[model samples]
Target chain A: MNAHHLRRGALFLWTALLLAFIFAPIVSTIIFSFNADRFPSLPWAGFSVRWYEAVFADATILRGLINSLIVAGATAIVASFLGFAAAYVDYRYRFLGKVVYTALIALPPAVPVVILGIAMLTFEGRLGLSGTLTGVAVGHIVLAVPFAMALVRMRLADLDPDIERAAWNLGATPWAAVSGVVIPFCLPAILASIFLTAAVSFDEFMIAWFVSGVNETLPVRVLAMLQGQVSPKINAIGAIVFVVSMSLVVIAQVLIGNRADRSSKRT
Target chain B: MAFWAIPPILWQFAFFVVPLGFLVAMTFWSVRSFRLTPDMTLANWMFILKAGFFRSAYIYTFKLALLTALIASLSAFPAAYTLAFRLQPRTRRFLIFMLVVPFFTSYPVRIYSTQIFFSPEGIINAMIAPLGLGPVSVLDTPTGTVVGYLVLTLPLVLLLQTFALMNTPRDLIEAAHNLGCGRFRTILTVIVPTARVGLVLAATFAFVLSFGDYVAPLYLGGSNPPTLSILIADQVKSGNNWPRASVVAVTMILTLIVVMTAMLALAYGGRKKGRG
Candidate 1:
């Protein structure tokens, strides 16, 4: 008993140390974003929110945020639509070459971001879509689709097949069956995936580097700032972006969990 | 069913397959006065093959990947093991959530944070200066880049290995203990062996992530030999040489395939040895 107690204490201590190592950078960044000093460093310099004011006042940064919104919004819509369609097909009907479809959909996230970025840029250039916000959207769609598909498939696979079949037997057409039964069944997962894809597209930088032309996304703008100087302003903007996206992810998870609970009760 | 697969197939083929094929083909083509000409030649491939700079960059990238994988897996083991075996389920879930939270920060932002932390006039230097210790230069060096890589990869390693360790059977460890094995011996012979496949998969993921990253090396790897990813990015962003960039991309892709195969073999091998 004593040995077990000693072992548990050591494990807890080690875990605490590792957790601290992981949080150090993030906690420092969030703290120093309010640093009164010009440089983002320690010594407990007096706190100020002046850097947040700077971020809000910057027009170029705001434009980049708008550009990011456009790309991420389009990505969320297109990726979720295509991903749900693919996942629905795989789940509802048995078919040949389904595994190939699964592999093709999941493979993009595995490919190197730089390679994917350049490839899309070249391909978009071929279609005369290069150097436009639309081109960036094109890359974002590809980048985000895999995640959307995986999420949709997971949700779709969990649904009871009898509900959809019952709808079909009640004189509903295939499309009608899906609209009535399947769409409602997978709505929460679809919504969650849309938000998740938006977060991913918003965070992406490499694809934006290669595919985007005149307009910079928020991350690209941050990269440009990084080239000249390291200031409290970078920390401020980074903290805001991090907080906003993390909240989106957490909120999406909460919403999805609630829907899942209600559905389980109904079932 | 066929109809369902068609749209996604067409979508992916148009956006992904065609572009990848185009990229590979471009490697064999030549450029004339900034224009891509479909003149098939081995000139670009030959150039990358012969360039000592590219050769060293490839080796250096592999080195970083290996080192990152080793460091992350070693450090992650205790944390993952603790979470899988020692903690209550609720506490374990909360800790896992906390580990994943940092990843929500943008990739470039996370890498950029390290820049401020390790600068010559930054926090580390300041702390050491007060102690009368000489200033340590970590920013822009390989060490800095490694630290950035660990910041991202370590948590991932922890999560992956925890899943693997949780899947391990508790009975095996108990059986070893019953067989008169000491605590350390049981852990060595039973627990570590059983966790090998999961551990290898976790390491493989870390290796691949660190290997292909361009943003980290571009921002954190100052004055270091440009990684293959940086070389690939430079070829297009600055050099306007798509074909040359494709050559590097092709090499990187091939390396990825080779590394994946090697890791999968190790996973299978580890499982067999553990069973034996």
Candidate 2:
């Protein structure tokens, strides 16, 4: 083979290995979810949905999943709204402390989630709000806000300010110019941020572990279950989470990619 | 106009900043048999510094973070390079999509899966066992923790590096190639140097994620010396030593800032060198 062919073969092999390494554990768990036995091991006695059925019947897991949804939902809404506003301000005004605001916006995710979780734990305790769903929501907001802000900021940075100014110059109110023009333009990015933040909040564990007092999210429950030997029920939950999360991410990517393509074409 | 910015700022201050300030303040306060006191002392800091266990945890955790960051960045380089240059656009997009799938899943679930993969009778051992390799105890070892960290952060590095590589001007690479540079030479001298900033940023992020990670070590690391995150959690949860935990938290935050700043500086320096 020529050198170019050798390079191509090597690249293909490397990519396959990388994908295998990334997906193997995930695929294994998915397979285990259908195993007849409880533990994750070889000799799949037979494919069974008993674990799925068991997961459905488990009240605690069900409750945890519901709680996770509620928390993630609330987190997404609050984070997107707040983050959108911050991004707007940062985009529109080159104010003093703008850099500070940007830094703070990027700070949470950069910090260890565990530290943030611990900080929230102690912080909530001072406010007499320890171990509440609201407390967990607050933590999720801190985690999700930065992401939302970053996403919206990227979208806003790409926006032509002249369009909004032109709208306002044509007798449109400032709010009308923003809502009727800018927001409509940025809708895909906003939607992407919402789904991305929701996925993030839903999958969050350490923060939930710390802030979730009496309330347990699905991840925390999974952690508890894992302390025992690997249960097939956990695998069932994993399969559902994996499928749902992957679907949402794919949808978000498509939306973002479409937005990018449109914007690039316009430019 | 001011209302939108003010409320969120105030909200973050009231909820996030104030609470964190209280936590930090509490760290300096005395802890008597699990109950906190208002008395101020440097005892927490002193205790953390003096304690051999805490010192070891700090060193070991930093070491693990560094190792994981190095491994993640090196492995991701070729993948990122190929995606940026070699792959067709359609295939690149699909690969990138697949790369981020792990991120969307719940953090605990991923760690749990890692545990399954590493466990004595888990899929990994089961596969190897048939080849007469016997069982390899991947779970609870430093190697297992490293593997878990690698799996978690590799995609991130790949994404960031790919973004950086894609953003590089194509003409620059073509110019180098036209000057009689070999393909690998073009990539090394022209592409990697330009991509160094993003690689550093990605590595820094990987480092921070691995360093601060508590859940992975908690679930997958068995009997091994705990990472600093685990140590901090143990202090808060089991030891109930809030002050000590605070000290650890402070150390971690400071270390993160220092590492991040250093990485950014290195990236900036590299950019200047490339320009020169």
Candidate 3:
């Protein structure tokens, strides 16, 4: 019994250490962002938000932030719409090429971002869409739609087909049944997908780097800044980016979590 | 259904499929005066296939990816086991949430921050300074890259493994214990086999992500030995060699197809019906 207790203690310690290792880098970045030190080192400099101020002062960084917001916002709305449509199709009908359709929808993310980036750069260059924010948004939508589909599909799996059918049998039009029943049922997932995909586009670097030439997204901007020099200002940018993405993700999780809890309770 | 499905299908075909197809076709085209021109030639393929640097980079990337996957799987198993079997559901759920939060954060920022722990005069070295260990260089090394890869993959692998382990029926484990199997023995002879698919998938995911990654290897490893993704970027940015970049991208896609197919086969192969 004593040996078993010791073993359990060791395992707990190991898990704790693992979590620490996972979080250390991000935590350090956040901590250092508030430090007034030029270099992140032993002697803690006085607390300051100068780096954050510098991030705001920089015109290029500001442009990158705006561009990222626009791309993420556009990508979120369109990807969610298309993702809902695709997911609803999967839920509502069975077709001859269903497997193939699913595979194709899921294929974009499996392809490496580098390959996808170059491919987008090549194809969009032809359409005169490369080097534009719209092009980056399009690329992000391709990457994010799969996730949106997956999320909405999960929620749909819990939905009884009979519920929608009963609505239709009660003289409701297909469109009305969809808008009144399916849409409301999937509202949480749709909203979650919006925030999640927006976060995805916000943090995505490689595709944006390839497609957004002059209109660099925040992540792409950060990469350029990192390659150029080691600046404490990066910590500020990192912290802000981290906060924005984290907030979006947390809101998404809460949205999904509430539905999950309610569903589990019902079952 | 057709109305809902056809639009996404068309969109994916136009944006995803056509672009990939165009990439393959472009590989056969040549670059003239820094401009991609319409021409059918194998010169790009020939050059890339024959280049010593390409061969070395390919081998290096493959080896690195394999190492990352192996290490990530092995390390994640213990933590996953604890989460699955030891922790209460509420605690486990919270821990899983912690693991997942990293995915939404900026990956580049994470890789960049890893430099703080690995760089000379960085956190680790500074912490060990009083022990006379002084500064040890880890940044700009393969080790740094591995650490970055772990940052990217470990949380994901742990989550996958935990979910897989959680789904293992409790009765089977209890039956093994009743049969006088030791904890380690039960894990080896029963739990491992039961969760084999998920475990393999977790490793495969680690491989896929690391293999195609550019930022971690570049930012953390300093591109001392350029990975394929790095090569593609260099080809594009420096030489405007879209054809050569296309060649590399095609090779990568082909490699991924082969790897994914083989992994899926391995995960499902020879399993009894209904076992998975």
Local error of candidate 2 at residue A196 (angstroms): 1.7
Stretches off by above 4 angstroms in model 2 are A1-4, A264-267, B129-134
B1-276, model 1: which lDDT tens digit per residue? 555667776788888888999999999999998899997899999999999999999899889989999999988888898999888999998888888777678767777777877788777788789899968887778887788778878888999899888988988877888888987787677777778788899999899888888877777887387888899888898998999899999898889889989989888865555666
The segments of candidate 1 whose C-alpha lies over 4 angstroms from its true place after superposition are: A1-10, A259-267, B128-134, B269-276
lDDT of each: 0.84, 0.83, 0.91
Docking quality level of the chain pair in candidate 3: medium
Model no. 3, DockQ: 0.79
Candidate 2 residue-wise lDDT at B201: 91
Per-prediction TM-score to the true structure, in the order listed: 0.94, 0.95, 0.97
Candidate 3 regions exceeding 4 Å error are: B273-276
Better of 1 and 3 by lDDT: 3
Model 1, residue B216: distance off in Å is: 2.0
Ranking by DockQ: 3, 1, 2
DockQ of the two-chain complex in candidate 1: 0.67
Q: Report the lDDT of model 3 for residue A154.
A: 93
**C-alpha RMSD values across all candidates:** 2.2, 2.0, 1.5
